[model samples]
Structures are given as structure tokens and as C-alpha cells.
Target chain A: MLEIINLHARVGDKQILNGISLQVRVGEVHAIMGPNGSGKSTLAQVLAGHPAYEVTAGQATFQGRDLLDLEPEERARAGLFLAFQYPVEIPGVSNAYFLRAALNEIRKARGQEELDPIDFMDLAEEKLKLVEWGPDILSRAVNAGFSGGEKKRNEILQMAVLEPTLAILDETDSGLDIDALRIVAEGVNRLRRPDNATVVVTHYQRLLNYIVPDFVHVIAAGRIVRSGGRELALELEAKGYEWLTEAVPA
Target chain B: MSRAILQDYQALHPQGAPQAGWLGRLRQRGLDRFQETGYPTSRDEDWRFVDLAPLTGAEFRVGGDSPAVRPEALAPYRYPGTECMLLVFVNGQFVPGLSDLGSVPAGVTVGSLASITARQTELLGHHLGRYAPIESSGFTALNTALIADGLLLHVARDVQVPRPIHALFVTAGDPAGLATHPRNLVVLEPGARASVIESYAGLSEGAYFTNAVTEAIVGDGAVLEYLKIQRESERAFHVGTTHMRHGRDSRGTSHSVSFGAALCRNNLDVVLDGPGVEAQMLGLYMGRDRQEVDNHTSLLHAHPNCSTREVYKGILDGRAHGVFNGKIYVTPIAQKTDAKQTNRALLLSDHARIDTKPQLEIFADDVKCTHGATVGALDQQASFYLKSRGVAGPLARKILTYAFAAEVLDEIPFPAVRESLEAVVMARLNARGE
Candidate 1:
């Protein structure tokens, strides 16, 4: 569902993601394990069309459409969703109202009738259950004063409601506990199906134990230095990334 | 109009007038003060940032006895729900035929200042311009001199009026070189609580000037919630001043919203004289095209143990300019006073500008006062966040601006006002092609 060829991206004047290429097919979960400053987050930001990340040289295609040319919102409407590593805190806007507005935007783009408040509430309730979230989070300001675990779970809840074809989970397990991590991974697993895909980016192989991936790639110096099977994540966790970077010919 | 105004000032301020009764003496004294002060200039400290060039050069006559606008023409100014009392003014003249006070509670008195000149004359005598300074304020004095009639409302002691009183002011006839003045007096007796909504709207397509003043007195332990909304034609010029004095233990809240005009300036001042008095001053403005709006607010803590809060926000589009100056004063006797203020603006265009100033004068060392100001475009990061959620660019801007204003609007406790204000804000935004 997604393809990248020699992606070169930068945050301001400093280039973060060098030439990187990867592909994820339908019904497959691609796990990218990298250490800090490995450009794993940069890849997700570039894919999400973050304005701060300029794609200087890259050819990214999603569902047969060129992705780099579209604006962030256009890319989102074209079936792309990024679960932010750190969710933004939007004060003065109720979580429920903001989420509904987002859902309606996506629905409207699909030539579908927008969901009224009643229907929206029903859908929101069902989706909240995916992450074991409750109605209490609905009235609170968007992610304001939210606990780390609650923020992670809220990201999953938004994904379930948006139902993007290509979902990129950017360090969703970073600040989550074991229980919260499992709930988030399970939510992703439930949404998985043929003709759709998920990409899980994490620093550790812990979250991999919950949401199994068909392929694993270790990113270093902005490129995927190694590609292996699902067991490769465990092998890297055991050996660490020092040898991987050393193995890359200097 | 200038000649007539100068003539009246001369008549009101002849020498030896102070030797007469206190009222006559005061008027004569005020006349002399007016002669000495004449009119405020931008060079003055208080008017340093205010540009009165448009009003200075313009020649305008006092609004005369022209027939009121048709009822259908005033339909847009009406509000829904039960109105305890309604007052309508056309060209500064009271319109009793257009007013309705059937919903007022028993023992509450609501009448036109022109009609009940006898019974309310004494009450008006004691508190006319004494609560404010008309000598230095050209618009305030002009309104006082030419004001044909206005509103006088008194709520009995301890009575809580469940419904709000609506006051609508409209100007008729082409305003080629004419102006109107309307004065409103509102007094909430001891322990009485009420809400008043005053709207200044225009029906004429001409450039009329509306110079109005509203003075309010909150009796001991009384609570007053007042909202002033201004929606004038593009060619109109509006200058308004509101003076409020809170009695001991009384509470006052004023929310002012303006949609700009050719030239609009508002001076809202409050004096907290009684202990435990609390006051809240809030303002918001949304302007498009070449409209300009300037708002100045002052709060005085005269006695001990008082609290005050102020928040003002503005959204400027095209070449619109916005100005905000808020002053908070704490006297030596006003120990334990707590004051806070914030002014923020969103400039939608490169040329749009905002001048915000917060002045605090504290003679009491035991008081706590903090103020903040900011001017910026929409948050680029927040806009991107919403865009990534599938919302379009224009919709994203609307959401951000709405959230910015919601900081003040959300804290309102009344649901009806909250909903109505939301609708009004949304409609105003949509009118700007949002």
C-alpha cells in the first residue's frame, strides 16, 4: 500500500533522513527498530507531510498516487494517518468535538454524508472501547492534562475512527506501560485486515511482542541498514545497534 | 454641530455659576473645565495611541427630531427569549412605541429618561456625569449635551430578575454630517441581581456618528452582568463610554463585543469602592476590510479586598487595525487586591496590526497584579496538525481562531449566552468568507 524510493528529508537546514527506501504490502505490519537520531521519526513525519520536514529528494507513492506533492491534509484524506509520538495539547477544544470534526472531514472527503452528533457519539463510544478508553476523556480539553498512557490510547482511538488504509504508528509505545502497550497493540491488531497495512516504529522490540510484524528493518544514518524476518527484532534487542552501525561501511 | 456644542459649553460654564446651587454650580464648574480642556488630543498620555483625526475634522450636527425607522428595518436587532424590558432609540431620541416592558418583574421600574424626567430627575441629578469625566471627553460631553432621551432602569432591592433587559439603539436618516447621542442609566439596588444587554446597531447607509455613554451603579451586595454589542454600518462612526461604580460587596461583570465601523472607540471604566467587590471586564472584536476598532478600559481598586480580571481578544482581516489599552489602579487603602489581565490578537493579513498596552498603577505593596499581551498569526504547527487530520486550510484557520476566542467565551456560566454568542461568532466568521 506504500512505497518509498531514496527519501531525503530534513528538519530546517539539517538533513535528518538520508536516502531511504522501503515498501509495505497489504495486511502486513512492518516494524522499524532504530536507536535515537536514527531518522525513524523523520520517516514518519515526512510520510505525514509535516511542513517542518522538507522532502528535498524522494519519490513516495501511496495507493498509486504521488504522496510528496500533496499537502498534509490532502495526504491524510488520501488514506494516510500518523500516530504522533507526542500528541498535541489543544486547549479550549473538547476532545469529543475535535475528534468528531476530524471524522466528519474525512467522511466528507469520501463523498459520504457527515455523521450527526448522535451517530458520532455511537461511533465514538465503540471506538473508545478498542483502547479501553471512557467517556470522561470526551469532555476534557484535547489531550490537555492527559496522562502519557491516556494520550497513547487516545491516538489509537483516533486511528480506529479514522480507519486509514496506511497507518504509521510513530513511537506509540514510547511512554506507555505494559498494560497500556498491550491495549494499544491489540487495538492496532483488531483494525488490521487485507487491503490495508500498518507500520510500527519503536526503539525496543517490546511492542513487537504484541503486534507481530511480517518484516523487520533496522534504520541507521537515515537508511534501512538491515532487513530481516520477525525474529530479527529479538536478535537486534539481544545484540544492540552498536555492531549494526559499525557494520555499515564507514 | 461644533458651533452648537461650543455654544452649549459656554452657556453651561459661565462665571459665578458655582455660587448657585450645587447642581448648577457643578454644571458651571464642569463648563469651565470643558472650556479649559476643550477636547482630548492624541498627544495626551491617555490618548497617546488613539488617533482622533477622523472625528476632529468632521463637522456633524446633533441628531434632530426625525421620524424613527420602520419596525421591519429594526428586526435584525431583536433577541429571542423573554426580555424583562426592551428600550429602543432612533437618532438619539427615545422610542417608547418600539419598546416593551411587560416582562419586567413587579416593583421594578424601567422607563425612558425623557418620559419620566420628573420622577427620575432627582435620581439622575445625583449621578449624571459625577460618576465620570465629560469635560475632557468630547464624545461623552457631546452625548450629554445632545442626548434627547435614553434609558433609566432600577431593580428593587434583593430582587433577582431572571430574564435579561434588552436595549437597542438605531440611527435613522442619511448621516451625511450628523451625529447622535444616547445616554443609559442603570442602577441595581442593594442585594439585587440582573443582566443587561445593550446593542448599538444602525439601519442607515450613511456615515452617522453615535456618541453614547452608559453609567451603572451596583448597589451594596448587588450583582450585575452587562453585555454591550456593537454592529454598525460600514460608514458609521461609533464612540462609546461606560462608567460603572460597584458598591460595597457588590459584583460587576462587563462583556463587550464589537464588529468594527469606520471608526469605533470604547472607553469602559470601573471603580471598585466597596470591600469584597469583584469585577470582570472582557472584550472581543472581529473586523474585516478597512474597519478600525479601539477599546480602552480602566479599573480602580479604591477600597480594601477587591479583585478584578480582564481579557480581550481581536481578529483583524484585510487592513483592519485594533487597539487595546487596559489600566488597573490599586490605591493605598486597597490592600489584598488581586488583578490579572491578558490581551491577544490574530492578524489575518500582513498589513493588519494591533496596538495593545496594559497599564498598572499600584500604591499598595500587598497587591498582586499580572498582565500579558501577544500578537501573532495562526499557529503554523497547530494548523498543520488540523490539516493532517483531513481538515482543509480555511477550516483549520477557523478552528484555530474559534479556539483562541473560546478562551474567554468558554468560561461563561450561562448556557443561553454561551450558545447565542457562539452562533453570533460563527456567523460573523462565515460572513468574512471563512
Candidate 2:
């Protein structure tokens, strides 16, 4: 469903992602693990077409289309989703209003009819249960005064509503407690299907415990150094990333 | 240049027939003050950022014959779903044929200030020019000098007005330098409650001047909700001042929304004269295409245990300019005062500019006061966050800008007025292309 070949990206003078390559097929869950500054988040952001990062060299394709050439919204409309590590706070836009606008835009792009406010509210109420939240959050501003856990759940709620073909979660479990982490994991797990794929970018192994990945890849210095199955994450949890870095040649 | 324009105005309209009465003396005093001050120059502190050349260079004729206005032309300015007392004014003259008194409540007086009789003279004389002193502002002085006809609403003690009072001031005429000065007086007795909406709109895209002053007196334990809507012609100049005085335990709120006019200045002043007074001031101004809008507000806490809240937001695009100056003062006798002021502006173009200042003077040591101001372009992170949700770039920007404005528009209590203004604001924002 997604492919990246020798992707080299930079923000300003700093080259963050150097020669990183990965591929994922339909219905497969891929987990990218790395230590701090190893470019794990950068890769996810690059795939989402963040304006701050420029693709210096390499190619990224999603569903056989060149992802680097598309704008961020175009990428989103084309079924590419990135759950941000730090969700932005929009002071005046209600969460429901924003989500509906997004869903309508995506629906229009796919040649489908847009849902009206009443119909959208029905769908939103149904989706709220997946994240174990009530309807009060929908009326409030988007992440304006939300707690850390609420913001992460809101991201999951958005993911469930948009239903992207390929989703990338960048450190969605950082600020969540155990209960929030379980709720978020359960929400993502429930949305898993045969035709869609998810790439989980996490630094810890606790999140993988709830939503197990089929493939685990450890990245060092912007390059994936080790590739294995679910056991690889357990091994990394037992032994720090320094062991892997020392084992791999510079 | 200002002196020349003033001389021209004085030549055309002489301060006529100073007779033996308090009204005559008031008019004469206003004329004398206006002549002495002429017009504030750029050197004045309060008028530093505003250039008066456009207003002073134009020779405006005062008190012309009322221009013909089609009833259909007034439809866009009227609140359709809202039922209230309606008073219409054209070129500073009351149009009784076009107004509806609409079943006024008992002991509530709703009519034109020009129609006052001997029975209401005692009440009118006490509060006419009490709150808004004309010595400081030449525009206020001029409005007082030429006070002909405007709105007059009075609620007796312990009376609760069943409906809002809407005073619609429409300016329609030839583009030949016509000017109108409207004076509005609202007095609410103790334990009374009322809402007043003052709207100023222009039907003709002409060069005219609208100098208006509204003075409100809220008695002890009274409640007042005042709203001012200004949507003048794109080529018109508007200067308005609203002064309010709150008695003990009184509550008042003022919402000022400005959308049109080439150059507009709004001054809102409030004084908390008694303990337990609460006042809120909310304002929103949207300017585009070289339009200039300035809002100046002053809140004074003269007694103990009073609270005030003020928030003003501005949106400027193209080469439009905006200015916001807010001041909060807590006197020594005003202990336990709580005051908060916030001013925010969004500049949507490279040439759009905003000058915001917040001043606070607190003499009471045991008071809580906070003031903040921010001016910037659209937030980059917020824009990206919206776009990343599959919204197109232009639509994302528009939504964010609209949301920035909705923060203030949503504060309107009346649904009909709020919805109509919301529609107008949305249409205006959408008309500015991507």
C-alpha cells in the first residue's frame, strides 16, 4: 500500500532522513522503532507532506501515486493520514465542525455525497463510542483546552471518522496514561481491516502490546538497521537501542 | 485644512438663534467647543495613529432635506425575525411614517428625541448630555452642536422592557458631501432591564459624514444590553461615541461591530460609579480594501467591588488598517476590583496593519487586573492543521479567519440579530477571493 525508496529529507540546513527505505503491503501492520533523533517521526512527517520538511532526494508513492508532488491536503484526500505527535490547538473551531468539513472534503474528492450537519452528528455520535468519549468534546474548541489524553483520543476519533487507507501514528502514546493508552489502542485495533494498513511509529514497546504489529523495523541514523517480527520489539524493550547500534556497523 | 473645512461648515450652517433655554445654551456651548477644537490633529495622543485629512478636507453640509428612501431599500438593514420597537432616521431626521412604536410597555417611553414634550423635559434635561462630555472630542462636540433627531428610550423604575429597541439610522442621498449628526439618549431607572440595538447603514455609495453620540444611564440594580452595528457606505466616513454610566449593583454590556465605511472611529467609555457593578465590552471590526477602523475604549472603576471585562478583535485584509486602544482604570476607592482586557488582531495580507495598545492604571493595591494584546498573520500551524484534514488551502485559510471572527460574533445574545450579522460577515469574508 505504501513504498519509500532512499528517501532523503531535510529541514533547513539539517538533513534528518538520510537514505531511508521501506515498503508495506495491504492489510499488514508495520511498526518503525528508533531511539531519540533517529528520524522515526521525521519519516512519518515526510510522508504526510509537512511543509517544513523538503524532500532532497528519493521517492515516496502511495497507492501507485507520487506522494511527494501532492500538497498536504491532497495527500490527505488521497487516503494518507498522519496522527501528529503534538496536536495543534485551534481556539474557535469546534471539533465537530472541523471533522465534518474534513470528512466532507474527503467525500467530495472521492465523488461521494457530503453529509449534512444532522447526518454528520449521527455519525459523530456513533464514532464517539469507539474512543469511549461522550458528545461534550465535539462542542468544545479543537484541542484548545483538552488534556493530553483527550487530544490523543481526539486524534484516534478523527482517524476512525476519516477512515484512511493508510494511517501513520507518530508517538500517539507519549502523553497518555495506561488507561488512555488502552483506549487509544483499542480504538485503532477495532478499525483494522483487510484492505487498510497502519504504520505505528513509537519509541516504547508498551503500545505494541495492545495493537501488535506484524513487522518491526529498528531505524538508526535515518536507516533501518534491523528488521524482524513482533519478537524484535520485545527484544528491544529488554535491551536498549545502544545494543542494536553497537551491533550494526556505522 | 481642518480650519478651512470648519469655516465652510460654520458659514453654511450658522449657530442660529441662541434663545433663553437650557437646550439653547447646551447647543451654544457645543458649538463654541467645536469651533475652539476644530478637529483633532495627528499631534494629539489619542489621534496619533489616525490621519484626519480625509475627514477634514471634505466640506460636509449639515442638515439637508431628507433624501427619498424606498421602503425596499431598508429591508436589508432591518432585523426580520426580531420583534421590537423600530425607529427610522434618514439624514438625521426622524421618519414617523416609516417607524413602528410596536406596543411599548407601560411607563416605557420610546420615540424621537426631537419629539420630546414638556412632560418629559425634566427627565430629558437631567441625562441628555450628562455621560458624554463634548469637551474632549471634536466629533462629539459637533454631534451635540447639531443634535436634531435620534432615538430616545426610557424605562420607569422596576420596569422590564418586553422587547429590544432597534434604532435604524440610514444615510441615503446624492454624493455631494452630506453629513448627519445623531444624538441618542437611553435612561433606565432602578431595577429596570432593557436591550437597545443602534444600527447605522448607508444606502448610497457616497461621500458623507455620520457623527453620532449615544449616552446611556443605568440606574442602581438595572441591567442594560447595548449593541451598535455600523455598516456604512464604502466611501462614507463614520465617527461614533457611546458613553455609559453604571449605578450601584447595575449590569451593562456593549457589543460594537463595524464592517463598512472608508474611515470609522468608535469610542466606547464606561464608568462603574457604584459597588457591585459589572460591565462587559465586546467589539469586532472587519476591514478590507483600504478601509480603516479604529476602536477606543475606556473602563473606569470608581467604586469598590466592581468588575469589568473587555475583548476586541479585528480582521484586516488588503491594505486595510485597524487600531485598538483600551484602558482600564481602578481608582484608590475601588478596592477588590477585577478587570481584564484582551485585544487581538489578524492581518490577512502583506499590507494589512494593526496597532493595538492596552493601558491599565490601578491605584488600589488589592485589585486583580490583566491586559494583553496580540497582532499577527494567520497561524501557520493552525493553517496546516486544517489543511491536513483534507480541507483545501484557500478554504482552510477562510475557515480559520472566520473562526477568529466568530469568537466575538457568537457573543451576541439575540439569535436573529446574531444570525443575520453572522451571514453578513461570512458573505463579506467569502467575497474576498482566495
Top of the candidates by lDDT: 2
Q: Output the number of the TM-score-best candidate.
A: 2
* Tens-digit lDDT string for candidate 2 (A96-128): 988999999999999999999999999999999
> Using Cα atoms with residue i matched to residue i, what is each candidate's TM-score against the true structure?
0.80, 0.82
Q: For model 2, state the Cα shift of residue B198 in Å.
A: 1.3
Task: Report iRMS (Å) of candidate 2.
Answer: 1.8
lDDT, candidate 1, B1-434, per-residue tens? 35766554445446665435444454455555555565577987777665777776777676557675778887666765344477888877778788777766775778787787677767778777777666648567656654456777788899988877878888777766667767788889999998888788877766778788899999999999998878887778888899999999999889898874687888998999799998899988877787888889989999988988899999888888888999898999899999999899999888888888888999999988999998998777778778878976677777788777766676555555555666667776667684
Each model's iRMS: 1.5, 1.8
What is residue B411's positional error in candidate 1, in angstroms? 4.2
RMSD of each: 5.3, 4.8
Off by over 4 Å in 1: A3-23, A30-43, A54-61, A64-69, A84-161, A169-190, A200-250, B6-36, B66-72, B81-84, B173-176, B303-305, B332-336, B411-421
Error of 1 at A78 (Å): 2.1
